[model samples]
Target: MEAMPHDPAKPEFTPLDVPPGGLETPYGILYRPLASGLQILVLFAAFIGGPAFAWVIGQVPGDLSQTARDVLFVPMVAIFFLGYGLWIARLNAIAFHGIGLGLLKALFKLIVFRRKPESVADFIPSRDKLLEMMVRAQQAGSSFAPVGWLVGVIAGLTAMLFDSALHPAKLFLLVGGGCVIWAHLLAWLGRRNWLPFMESE
Candidate 1:
């Protein structure tokens, strides 16, 4: 028997069917799960006395022993890599799942309607309403952790880079935050856009 066709507007994916390991990417990649966390660590590790470490590194006491210098430098190196790696990985996720897919959806819509645009407007949702939507996505067996682990990393990066290059870390945090937010947004846009890996198509 011949197989039945699929519908694009209403993709086979639904919040209830989101993969247990991670999200479905816009492309065929095995995307990571969407979530956030580790607030207190981010708070103290990145802020508070974090700036002091950079300052200590910057104006090291001329008489201090080489051993003292090594101690300060090691963690800085570790933080530098950890902070940078997470932020970059987060960006890759966003590029593939968020921005890239969003563009694809726009293209799909344009091709379908000749750019006339379909009207799907509604009133702006209140904070509570938005929170409720997140809850709903979770209730449907979808993974939706709203805590960002990058916060502490970004904070650590901020303290370390306060004297040199602050912008990179801040930019990374912004991009990462935007990425997570876009993932949250998928609770609404996922099924509508025929996203890849979402339905095993």
Candidate 2:
């Protein structure tokens, strides 16, 4: 009997099954799930703080003079975008699904878009040497947990206080209270075992 040709549009099937072991990367790194505490903190900051800060900006009075509004909006937008980009990058690092692919996307911009080095550096990892340092930090089980989170929180609180006091048209109570609500949600989620692992990619 003659064999029939397979259709090109049809999908191919493989008998192979996915292994349960850690995921391996072409760079020879095996990405694994993150610790519970780390996951909670990561997600909490991204989901809660990200939106709250945006909300506060939205609440800023539009009636302010153009120059004043522009002055405030410029910094607010910069911080919002920076926080959002970092959040996604950190999530991908832990998830193993974001690093190489994300890097490739960034590289295209560098090549075709004529993006500046400093801007590229912000999105991409430093040089190969710096990436090596990051990998070493990951392998040694040493993380910046202790003071890193504390400093970030303190800095955020300080910024909030300054923004409230300086921007008379902004509703200080709403912004500050929203931050507290965001933090409370994070603690609640962490306690409920709803957080995911957040280790580096």
Candidate 3:
């Protein structure tokens, strides 16, 4: 009889097949390219649009003092960030039930009490521990970024209020440097999956 090649006694196990469209979560559909593109577009629009709008408004005639413009501009920037965050949360919620409302409530609680839910899984995942961690980390970073900006703005503005003699060039450099640092930090976090909205394939 011809020798036969021995076959393995057991077949190797394969991982559970993911759905063709990838996983769905309460926050949104977790598809790759589309999700990534939408997130980039939204973030870019908000960041750029905020400053541009502020500049346009500042140019309008009113003889508004520079301090007043600075104050107004800071709030406008904050509003852009807030609006974008809420809109994206809502868009994600449309895929799953109550996620938008839940997110808003949770955000309010966190802001008011500096308290987080006992478990993020309660919001992002019912069963997947890994996914829960990913979502929570991203959400935390997202929340922190705006707060950090706000803190910087408030401090800068407070100093300007007390001493209007602060050099404009120095102030511009400080703010610009801080913004550059923030952008780089956010980019790093996004690469590490810390920024959920900025996550890509």
Candidate 4:
């Protein structure tokens, strides 16, 4: 007897029949390898580009008017922070899933002395499912908590650097206070189980 070739367009078997690395999401085929490479590229670009851009801006000729300089400078600064926010949010998500939550739980147990702190596993459904939750959370805006704080920090630093009238101490204090409030809001959302995107379908 002769054998027939497999046709992916007309899948004859269940999803389990699909091999590893062939998983597809609602968005499209999950190109794990390519995605990983792109993530590395993005991280490298953000970290390296910030200081490089700053240096380039500093080298700008002194002949340009203050208004013209501001036009160029302000947008570059915004771009730097935009990149910083995105990368920071991604890093925070990775840390939260990997070991950050677990470490925080242990630290709380050591300090509170009331009862054994629940494990990260208790809050999270499963390690394997975390990637999906993270993706969804990122889409839903919950994962950008770190981004907001990073932007605040960048804005505060920029103000201090460029505006003599602005008090550096007050700017930093305001940014720090805003970050604290944002952190608490995120914590509250997590406590209420209101992170809709993180919930399993």
Candidate 5:
């Protein structure tokens, strides 16, 4: 298998006939053309970012109130760090389940059942500037993923604060929700022919 870059100036959506590439590198069909750079970033996040974040947390003033630390780790700054870390760690699959499976279901329903599905537009915009943004992302490599992370964190945090007091469901949404937003962006890319799709000879 080999990774090949296509011209992003003119985008091509993937054809559904042959097997499509894996969403990410580890799955093995499509490789990161800039796999080396991403690998380095992963190493830095694991070795450098992970340990640094832990050390910084450890340095928090021992005399501070429990509530303060809780906010920092629970609903505030930690959420940003976590939102970022989740994407880096690729542990955010739970976020993609809804939209991912829903889109698949919609496609299957239309194809197999020979009935049009309404949920397709709900998962993605039928036509709008968002499509333009998604096209740009198709070319920009995976670096654009954080856009979803940032938005999801802000939305989740706002919900948590408005309700006040952490609830199990809200907290689940807090971390998990961010991944959902990011996953959509990934899905947009995964389906497109703009990627350097690796295929077996």
Candidate 6:
């Protein structure tokens, strides 16, 4: 034992294997990468776009008295949920239980995406086309992610209209359900034509 040599460079050499049904970042509990990345983008757009949109909401020079915060935050939350569910589909290699865990993790981390500079920074690298390919390899739904964001924005606005009586519950039910249904629909439509090589290992 006393004669054992230490290798500083190889410190602990941990394998980068995601657990059978779990995920962790060096920072701690994370979702599958593509989903994580999409959530991060939604977070990024929200923080960057939220305040400005909020200001516009207040300044539109009309009877519209709503705060800019709602204008920004609603879409942010909506898209995040949609993106999150589709992201879960990517991890289908994992058990359904694991996917649920991943989805829950994504929901929990929703707030984490709000922490400034870091949030914005995360989105920048995800713009790489190669990164999308990598995400696809993992079975994450990159194809519909953009459309998911659009659908999320629409759903968010719709929720806002019904907010007075519905509050947050409506948003959750509608957005979450829509994401699941649309994702499955898209998957089905693409099934016949989808290139199998695009699937993950």
lDDT (Cα atoms) of all candidates against the true structure = 0.37, 0.42, 0.47, 0.45, 0.41, 0.42
Candidate topping TM-score: 3
Q: lDDT for model 2, on a 0 to 1 scale?
A: 0.42
TM-score-wise, the better of 4 and 6 is 4
Clashes of each: 8, 1, 0, 0, 1, 3
What is the full ranking by lDDT, best candidate first?
Answer: 3, 4, 6, 2, 5, 1
* lDDT digits (tens) for residues 1-201 of candidate 2: 988997544433443222345334333343343566787676666555644564454445444344433333333333333433443455455434324655666678789997744443444443443334333323322122222243334434544444333453234433334434443444343323334534333
Candidate 1: 10-residue stretch with minimal lDDT: 192-201
Looking at model 6, the pairs that clash are: 54-68, 90-139, 90-140
Q: Report the lDDT tens digits of candidate 6 across residue range 1-201.
A: 587775533323334454444353333332233354554564455335434443443343233335423553454344444544555555453433333454555556666775333232233222232233333434443334465546655655554554343455555455434544444444332222221212234
Model 2, which residues run further than 4 Å from truth? Answer: 1-49, 60-170
TM-score (C-alpha, index-matched) for candidate 3: 0.32
**What would the per-residue lDDT of candidate 5 be over residues 84-135, giving only the tens digit for each residue?**
4543333223223424655677778778999776433545433332333333
Candidate 4 regions with alpha-carbon error over 4 angstroms = 1-70, 97-99, 102-125, 133-201
Query: Can you list the residue pairs that collide in candidate 2?
Result: 93-201
Model 3 lDDT per residue over 7-74, tens place = 44422334434465545666433333236566566557546654665555444434546875565456
Could you give candidate 1's per-residue lDDT for residues 97-172 as a string of tens digits? Answer: 5345655666777889777333321223333333344333232221211222333344334434333333555534
Instruction: Show model 5 residue runs off by greater than 4 Å.
Output: 1-38, 53-201
Better of 2 and 4 by lDDT: 4
- Among all windows of 10 consecutive residues in model 4, the one with the lowest summed lDDT is 192-201
Give per-model TM-scores: 0.26, 0.27, 0.32, 0.31, 0.24, 0.29
**For model 1, what is the C-alpha lDDT against the true structure?**
0.37
Candidate 6 regions with alpha-carbon error over 4 angstroms:
1-58, 67-72, 93-201
